[model samples]
Target: MLKTILHYINVNRWRLIKISKNNFLIYCSVFVGLMGGLAAVALKYLVHFMEDLSRNIGAHVPFHFMYIFLPALGILLTILYQHLVNRDQIQKGIGTIIFNIKRNKANMKFNNVYSHLITSSLTVGFGGSSGLEAPIVSTGAAIGSVTGRFFKLTTHQKSLLIAAGASAGIAAVFNSPIAGVLFSLEILLGEISIPTFIPLLIASATGVVVAKILYSRQLFHLATEGWHLQALPFYLLLGLLSGWTAIYISNVAHKLEKGIFKKQNRYVRAVLGGLILGVIILIFPPLLGEGYHYLQEVLNGNINVLQEESLFSTWLQHPLIMAGFIAALVFMKVIAAGITLGSGGNGGTFAPTMFTGAFLGLFVAYAVNLTGWVHLNTSNFIAVGMAGALSGVLHAPLTAIFLIAEITGGYILFIPLMIVSAISYIIARLSNSHNMYWHDLIHEKNVRPDKDYEMLTAIEIRKVVNRKYTAVKRNRPIKELYKLMAETSTNIFAVLDDEKHLQGVVLLDELRKRIVDGTLSATATIEDLMIEPPAVIEYNQSAEDVMDLFDTLDVWQLPVVYHGRFVGFVSKSNMLTEYRKVLIGQHHQPDPFGH
Candidate 1:
């Protein structure tokens, strides 16, 4: 029934709306945004519901240690679900989405639209240490990609809608429309213009509206007396600290994730990772789940919240102990998050980054205040620190700046936010050229940043190979080659051994020249007439490498060999034609909605 309705709408869209392609795209963006916002709302409500349920159960139970087991149980359940139902096929993280957009023409599976919604809710709601933002973005991008496919849109249109969904997801999650648009542009789209910006703006605004109407609670509330010029140097120091901290978090989290998953058995990995994560949470209770409640407490100057359920509760009475506890939370949060995700639990690092940043900021302020060296506003540093850490970790300064400002309503501290975020970003970039997401993609997935290279990578070598070229045994008479050339339209012929291995190539031009110069011998074999090819392309070679060889060798055609056996000939003209088709498909915007 849903399919029939969608088909009807698709068939009559032009007649019903009579709008231009751009305007029609705007309308699609609205729907995508609405769906993205709804996804965010659903995820939030589910996670909160689970948290409340867990809290209620904990209140009634006599075993306080049971809370530590909750994370392990959640991760185990997530792993079970993945294996039993999802077939362990769900791909998590924002890097996967970026790779698909660049290398797969922005196509996504339909199951992704709801798979993340279910898996993330289960993982995060059960007290896993990760965040729901990455899952939400993945769900939203799938919605946009599926929607574009449903309407039979162009590749560019599909990509635009994917970005639109991601923007909406971020906007709705934080209730920050501008930050959402910037997230898409900075992280996903990489570059944008007016036409693209308008759709993203509309989509982000629509998503915010949906989130506000359905789930109206503000994400964070801040009461700041503004920044003081005297705090400039402190903010600068905090910025540098945040940068190094961001590097530490990225590296530690990445290493932990790698180490945990390196185990052979999935269940063993889960049990091991979950136990370690549970122990971390046990020592520093504030590291539980998203830790936003603790972040809020820090923001409100209630540093005491960190000790509520911690093993160090009694020891935190001393100033130095409390500072140490806060510092420990800052570092341990990333470890917990890495364990949660690597153990087969599904979630993102966005919340963990912010959570760590808030605590890091509080630690800096608390330590400085303890010395009585100029009273620094703890709340101001916390807010700026959140932006600084976010900027450094994600390498998205604009997104980090606006998202913090919008969520906290701390525009008064915009200067500090800018200062810290810029410094942190510079430091992080100096340490690692690519952000965490891009770094993983480049090293793990072998994805390249060059557009042409990626496009060529997507093209299959077999698709452009001229299999119609005639092949002759090396012992065949030269007259046989002449007879075959007259029968076939191909100008190139492959000279193969009895075992079908490529020995050499025969060119019609060379053959005609030999014939005209009276140097051709009718009794000569194909080996005598054939010339060695400048290069040979393996059948499984990448199109990028093939193109490089073509340019380097200055040849129009190259023979393809598979397992040392002759396959077919690939031509420069054919490769260029295929490349042009892909370029046109990605760049050309046809009028799907006729005027």
Candidate 2:
């Protein structure tokens, strides 16, 4: 009984709790949302905590010395975080999430998640060129999932809580509750179902409120106090280009991350990452740190934007040089993103994405102004283009649209924001990029997308698992059951009627339970204790590739069927070993992965 109780608790924890179909879950969602908001607030504070320490230290260091110290700090801190704090922090941040869903039975390791959060915060705080929002989103969702586990949640309940957590995180960071909710649905949860949508909304609202209460200031700084809207069509062109730029960034981030991950030793990989950061910082100090200062300069338009403006710092502006530098910096940021992930220097992809988009916008504005549109407002074009590209990359157009309006405080960049965001999403999709974070991470695991990612924009269990199946007679005793399971040593086994068709599943845990309980005598049949019609994976399917199903199906293993017969089974352990084998390469050869 003690064992049974313990197993029940383990199985049920970190799940969504269902009080009822309607009333109870909704209440739980409210609680989850509030906590999510708090988590976001905490994440922001944590990031600043690191930044404050860096600022104190950096104040003493010479300006040029920052080029050396910044990257060195990135190196030391990264090694410490990976080797000492979270060994499992590897697989990249987004990849870690996806990998856990695939191989770890959808069981998220809370220790590892928060470890990444703090470490990532430190990376950016200490002048690492990365983003704050990505880590926060990942950590917030992880915290929500971990907290939900404590409540004995159901799978649906857990997903709801997780979505709420993500929404809160985004809302808190951007101070845009609507965008937070949209980010949760579009990026993390990948759906806007009633079950997920309502809870996420509450969470985002709570998060935004908390951020507002704490900061009482705007999140993004957009300068458009006295801009003319007569050149709206020109702004549309800017948006179109910016959107295309977002797609380009996404592709670059993915490809580079994959290439960098191939490095054999973690230390060597990290050292290389440090070296790259060093080079970029040396060339352009504005490109150093988390890039907030660089963004501020762009917003303030204090420095020359055209690469050749006035003095180096405050002199006249140089348009040609400014354009070249912006373009170069755009490429540099993508490489930085890849390096951050490769070195395990914990940070989000969103912050870098936003910074790159802003630069891209500025580039377009500069070129347009060069065309003799001097009467047009360069700052206004910059604001709209930035917002639109941000929206497009994030796949949250509505949120992106409204967010700019709010961040700019009643100033309207809506028309240009829509144009850029929509087109950017299209271009990114056209280039076959997934969420940069998720895609880069997935690619790290070397899992080829069987279908175009667009086909998987959202996945259904039916697509991943098949109902049709073949099985053995359940009337057979344990001796026969062992034989069948031996042939297919997966977590789940099919128990059929005399007709050799589906009846129930002999899950490994259930099988172990029966053995320990001694409930079934040697003569007893499989029917005495089997789950009927276990979730099945159809052959030739896209692997739906989500962590949610592991809990919802309540099995660590699943059988795969193609036309009418059982082809194979996929288990959590099986997939993990597969990844492990790939990582091991030519050195080790586990039977499952031995070439």
Candidate 3:
């Protein structure tokens, strides 16, 4: 059985770890890379197979009526799968992978390997306007997480393997190994070093090799010879537009994700999303699914005939009309992609972003050509637009440049890619502080990538809490409270109930004022002088959040609560000291303990 094999591997991996940790990680990275590549292959093939199956089914139906229900069916099936199989509810996506990396120490569930593969494939292949890249990335991260667990890897080692698997998945999908490495570093790992780089590079290259062996077709091509110095200004302008477009798409996608999909009934939302998507695709077939075929048509100057076979062919003949239509499609694509995800469908914005950028470029080229002011190479613009838009959306200019150049075989456009990607990245950075995918992580989940801060986030409030503080009974006189504060060498005193439950705090400052006024009385109880604490820290809350509470409340300390009982108080000084220790430890600085 598989359990026997895992047990054998687990026992031997400890022996290997004794030999060398680095060697064990390097060896494990190879297996993670292979698994990532294989997962990518499997997902891509499944998507294609489902696409073909849908096409065959649509052939027999009148007016392709099956298209309306296909996405709904796919989403419902995914929901059904969640109810039946994923009852424990392991979230499936790149976001969950990144979340686990930062919060869970890269501990991922084994089921993620197949969960996203099945759901995302059904979502995209059955007419959902989304990408498969995220699902594959999720699957790959799961593979690495489980593999690391199998070897009992350290937290940092597990994180590196997760990054390696993600890189391998991207490399396999796009056949761009260098971009894959950059993607992991910029978006996932957030740091670069030789130890991380070598493993990621090996995994990425291995992934591309696997892809080449299995599926040798390139994704896109561009005749970059047409890129001239005369087009420099236009490319710059395109970069600005691409960056703004990315910001718009990101904001709209996130807003829709949080707003319209407000945890409503899945069936109702799915129906609404499907109806709107069906209507849009029926009117503009180029906006359907990934729209890669239509992008090729636009690049070839076949926009007028690209979707002429659709039901809305009456307005498709005129070049000006088609240009305006394509421009509108660029914005609508963002909305549809948002809806596809918001309506319980599973997919990513990667392919749809490229689709939007390419058409937006074509539209700009057409509009300028019609003015008879400047002649522009539409194909070159399309390529640059893809890079710029990707940079803007991802806030990762290097990954954008290399991903486009490698996928399109456009080495000649490298300078232009750099130019456009940089411009777009700057504009996007100004417009939005974080990448589209990172909003939930940074804001809601507090999973930032900074190592020192992450270390602080990893520390719990209980670790730094001052549990030796004196607790006075609520009915204790103010004079006795003064004695307790003086004897305890603490400025703060807690008033506790009979059951040791927290009631309030009695500050020495307040007692000093009462004593100085000569108004203190023997009958005045501690509760009379006690004031409710401004902030409370939970036992399991992160030190980072505890620091935020301190900063927000402008207090030196906050009461730590477990249930309703008073555990202790965590002071700002202790939190800061621990934070300094974590920072120093992260940099391998010499400590007093010689650790």
Candidate 4:
């Protein structure tokens, strides 16, 4: 029966492939959108369920007091799950997804489909200072990837599916379909082809519809008073502040991961991180979990709601004190999110970015209003600030703008949103070349796109190394070299010692010149015909480096060496062929989904 089922599947798969690419993708998009939406809803339910359970356990304990040990336990459980059950490292959230697209040809790990849901639920549900959007994005991308594999989809189709999944997941979470589509195009795929856009639009719209059906509440329903032109300068200033804050978030998270948590034992690091986070939570309960509730409080001009819940309620009532507290949140949020995720919490920076943006906007508005120089609507500033921080941190201005507009019920603060996002994006670009996600892939792995280098990055030297070239002993007779040339295809040969250590190379063209001159005797040795190669190519050398060497040396071919042994010869021609292949993979191929 199992064999028959397998046979049936194979036959159906063939039929599916026979469908036109565009129609098949349209069909897959609907499935991916529906599934991605369901995954988002399920993740939200699990998180809320865990949160309710944790709350029940802490019913008698003060909210701050309960977090002292809750976040610690959650981190420990997350770490143990990875170590004992999953037995794999937690990934770098959406960065890994983009890396897979660029370097791994969109082939995603199957484990990501469910692992993020498990670990992130545990982390955020139990009060870890993190977000759910990243995990759900990972889950959605994995869904697209596995589905592509199941149908044996083309590489382009697989990539589109992955993008669609990501967009859908984000759309479901925020109930903002346009933002979802923009996020996939701006951040994930980095290209805007019409063929890709249709599927993304369908998936994102479907995801949002599902989210609405299951959980009808919009993420943020801000009554944003229209922005005043007088506040334009202040908005610009807020943009700069948000840009700097974004830099702090990106750098602090990256530094903590590399410097603090990198050397410590995983278990020990997780404990220390959790304990520290708990202390912060005890001091600033708003930083706990997703912090969305606190964000609403701030935007609603009820910043004192958090003060009422704090141990220092009396001290927090002072206007200056309240302002300082809110400002401190903007800076400390970076540390809170960094430590939580750096120490093994399975959550993303998405929620934290929004959290930081909302509070930062509130702080800026409150501070400016206190000065009596400008009258700014606190809610308007909060919405604009969200866009500003998002633009800077995620390097996505359009997404930040549209997401804030849609969630806020309309584009009432459109001008301020555009101003803040544009300025913030520019400032972020000046601070760092790549956004929070792409920077790791570029600086850590050297996988960023460069017209000359991207093709080289995708291919390895072994793929183009000419193993067909033969090696001759340095002592072999020149007359024997003539006999060897007759037997072989072309001119390049490595002259090596008995142990195969490359001594030098013999060019058949040069040897043939000598042969034509009639200056070689039967006893003339290959050593006499050999000369030091201008440059030797290492088998592991990057394609860019190899190409650079070729141009620098003006050589048509270079002998390839690997760990003190002669491997083969690599020619300029082979490099060009590989580069063209890469170019085709990246750009030149006919659209897999044509109209």
Candidate 5:
């Protein structure tokens, strides 16, 4: 009765259905969507709490004195969680989500998700210099998997759920549904097919609606000025610089973190990060928090930028002071963000990437302004360059550009956004680390985003099933069947006729039963004992489709056929083992950290 109800739910709820045999896959996707929605809200609240706390404590307390304290606090909390939770996995956060969706896989462990949330919050909140995108993505993927599992979705449906969950998470956090949809297709699923696009759009839009009602958050408040269309050349220059900065940022963080991996103790490594950040913060409090306030000042044209003072200069040179100070701070900000990540902090590179792009834009604008060739607003350049640079480095040109547009609703910057984002993305690809944060993570884990048994769990039955037939006429002797079962060492055999139609299957235990009843010597046909109308597969089904077959059938083995001929059999062992492989080294093996 429960199965019938679930089948009804699946059939009605989901538009895309893979199985012609049953409506079970449909049910699973509905389950994934419902659960994913709820989980997204919870995770957002958790992230918000950490961000709020980070602001309050850093501002009120003397961060200089407490900078060392914050690092110790983060380390102690982490060690304590490691002790209490007894988790054997490294918390890669969003990188883990990207890892799962790269194939028809889902390892959405709730405890692991919780671990990521806590650790990543600590990483960013107290001056770790990372972004918040990591936790959001992890939580989103977890929501999807949990939902799919509750409904017992097929592998392909689960894959779609993973993308949906990721999209929903992005929408909830950023409050941008379209960006979420594009990200789901481009980054998560790697496909934007009509079938996949519809669900992604629905899920992302739903998440955005929820987020908008709750947060009402503003993306960027800057009003774009009249962009010089002829300044296209300058925009390309900004793109080149932004791409270099992004590559530099990625390289520094990855290299430093990798270098530290050769060292032994976790605490000591963390302490080193603390010491570096503390020294930097002693001079610059703006570097201590999320750094948004400082960025806000730049966007508002209110920075106390340092200008250069000549030796012969008289009184205070205000302009020179601002230039020197601003340039120096940008460089220090990079160091702080880099050191924070190198020490195994949990946050993401997303926010930091935007921050770095803003700084890069400031530098270019300052230099451009110095030349007196063209006028550029500090705020507009940073805003537009940030979108372009982020788009380029992340390789989601449309999403980044749209996110920038949506943030400020800037009509003038549209063409520049397009031109700059593409240029930056192209320039960043010149060196290695072409892919964004998680794409690079996939390589470190050595798991191909592509499909294979050792790689992809969803194995097609037609590929591995035995094509030979052991069935005979009902009058065939039981002794002959017994010999066949022993010789083949197969647990089941499909009975078929000369026309190649499925008859029935005989188990090894059945042959033993006939022998014990003294009917072994008699000629009996295989059809009399075989199970008729065995499960079949169309040739076009994916590995994910095959996995759904295993889930619905609940049998150890099933004969696969196309056009009424026995082709092969798929076993439960291959399916389960293949799926579980995703979670294997994900716990034990220590890979290089996220980009």
Candidate 6:
């Protein structure tokens, strides 16, 4: 019945497109935004419902012993679902989305639309200690990809819709439409032009509408008395602290995840990671789940919640001891997040990063207050620190700044936010060029978000290879080369050995020069006349790498070899021709409103 309804809608969609393609695209963008927003709303409610249920259950139990096993149980269930129901490996986080756009032609699997929503809900809802934002973004991207496929849209259109969906997801989550659009452009679709902004803006706005109508609760509230000029130096110090802390989180999470995954058995890893995470949460209750509730408390100047379920509640009364406790939460939050994900839980680092930043800011403000030299506005620092850490960790300063400003309604702190965010971003970038989402893709997969690289990635080297060139054995007489060149309308010839290995290339211009100079020798073999190519291209090399060879050597054509055997020649002209086609296709956006 569902399939029949979808088929009917799809058939009518084509008719609508025929009437007006621009209007159809706009309608499609709106639909994608709605779906993305609905998904975000559903995930948030489900996680909160689970948290409430867990709290009720904990109230009945002593010492909250359930904390010791809840995280592990959640992770185990996530693993089981993937192994049983999903039956396919599901890649988590924003990295997968970026990888798909770069190498997969923006074609995400259909299962992704629901798999992440289900798995991440179970993971985080059951206390997996990770954020819902990453899964939400992935789900949104999948929705756009699937919607495009359903309508049989072009790759460029599909990519646009994907970004639109992601933008909607972020907007829906935070009720910050501009930050959503910026997140998509800055973190997902890199190097987009002005023409591409329409769909993103429409989608983000639609998502915000959906969220406002369906979910009325704000994520965070800041009752800031505003910042003073005297606090500028402290904000700068907080920015530096946020930067160093961002680096610490990235490196520590990377190493911890590596260590956890080294264990071959997934169940054992989940149990062990869950036990460690549970222990950490038992001591630092704020580290449990997304930690947003505690973060709100911190923003509200309610620091006493840190000792609610903590083992150190007795000693947390002392100002110095409480400061140390906040500092410990700042560091342990990352470990809990790392364990949750590394142990097979499905979630993201966004919430955890913000959570840590809030605590770090609180700790700094608390310490400064203790010194009696000057008092600081703890709430302002908390809000700004969230932006600072987000900018430093994600390498998205604008998104972080706007997201915080919009969420807290604290535009008055824009200058401080900017100063801190920029400093933290600079400090973080000095040590690591890419954020956590892009680190593996850039270092291990060699995927980059640069326009040229993305375009080259889209064009396959095999499609542009010219195999029409004649191949003459190296031992063949030079006369055979002339005859072959005459029979074929080609300017280049490949000289191969008996084993079909590429020996060298014989250019028509060189042969013509020899003949014109009257220096041609009939007795000469192909090898004697052949000149070595400046470089040889492996058949499986990426187009970007091939372009690099062409630029570095300044050669027009290079011989392509497969397993040491001569295959064909790839010319710089063909590569650029393909690149131009991609460039044109990407920029040729139809007016969505027919204006």
In order, the Cα lDDT scores of the candidates are 0.87, 0.62, 0.80, 0.85, 0.63, 0.86
- In lDDT terms, which candidate is top? 1
Candidate 3 worst ten-residue window by lDDT: 586-595
lDDT of 1 by residue, 1-595 (tens): 9999877677757533666677878999999999999999998998888777667666665544655777777788788888898887787888988988887788998888888888887778777899989999998899999988887677888989999999999999999999999998888878868988998898899999999999999989999989888889989999999999999989987876665757458878877778778777777777788888888888998888777876667889899989988888888889889989888889999999998888888888999999997999999999999999999999999999999999999999899999999999999999998889899889988886677876798689989988776888878778887678769888889888789888899999898899999998768888888889999999999999999999998889999999998889999999999999988878665555563
Error of 2 at 89 (Å): 4.8
Two-way lDDT contest, 2 vs 4, winner: 4
Report the C-alpha lDDT of model 3 over 83-199, residue by residue, as the tens digit: 677763657556677788777877998888788888888788888888888888888888888887776666677888899999999999989999999999988888888998999
Cα TM-score per model = 0.89, 0.69, 0.84, 0.90, 0.68, 0.93
Off by over 4 Å in 1: 1-17, 85-89, 258-272, 468-493, 506-531, 587-595
Off by over 4 Å in 2: 1-21, 59-61, 89-92, 95-106, 223-229, 259-264, 304-316, 437-595
Per-residue alpha-carbon lDDT of candidate 4 for residues 532-571, written as tens digits (9 for 90 to 100): 9998888889888899989998998998888989888999
Clashes of each: 0, 29, 0, 0, 29, 0
**What's the distance in Å from true for residue 85, model 2?**
2.6
Q: What C-alpha root-mean-square deviation, in Å, does candidate 3 show against the real structure?
A: 4.9
The TM-score of predicted model 3 comes to 0.84
The runs of at least 3 residues in candidate 6 whose Cα sits more than 4 Å from the true structure, single-residue gaps closed, are 1-13, 16-19, 258-261, 473-486, 521-527, 584-595
TM-score-based ranking? 6, 4, 1, 3, 2, 5
Q: Write one digit per residue (lDDT tens) for candidate 5, span 1-595.
A: 9999777566534433444312443344344444444455665566567667755766778635666557545644554566556464644555567666554356566565456667766666565666666567776677677665555554456667777777777766666777777877766666668767766667777777766666675655675566876566778888877777667766666665453544656667677666677667665555654566567667777554221112212322455554565566656666676666666566666776677677677767876787788877777678777776677557777778877666666657888788878877777777654455554565676544444433444344455555554555554655567678667877777666687666667777766786678765455556556655346665545556676677787767776767767666667786666556544532222212211
The predicted structure with the larger TM-score, 4 or 5, is 4
**Candidate 6's error at 287, in angstroms?**
0.9
The numbered model that scores best in TM-score is: 6
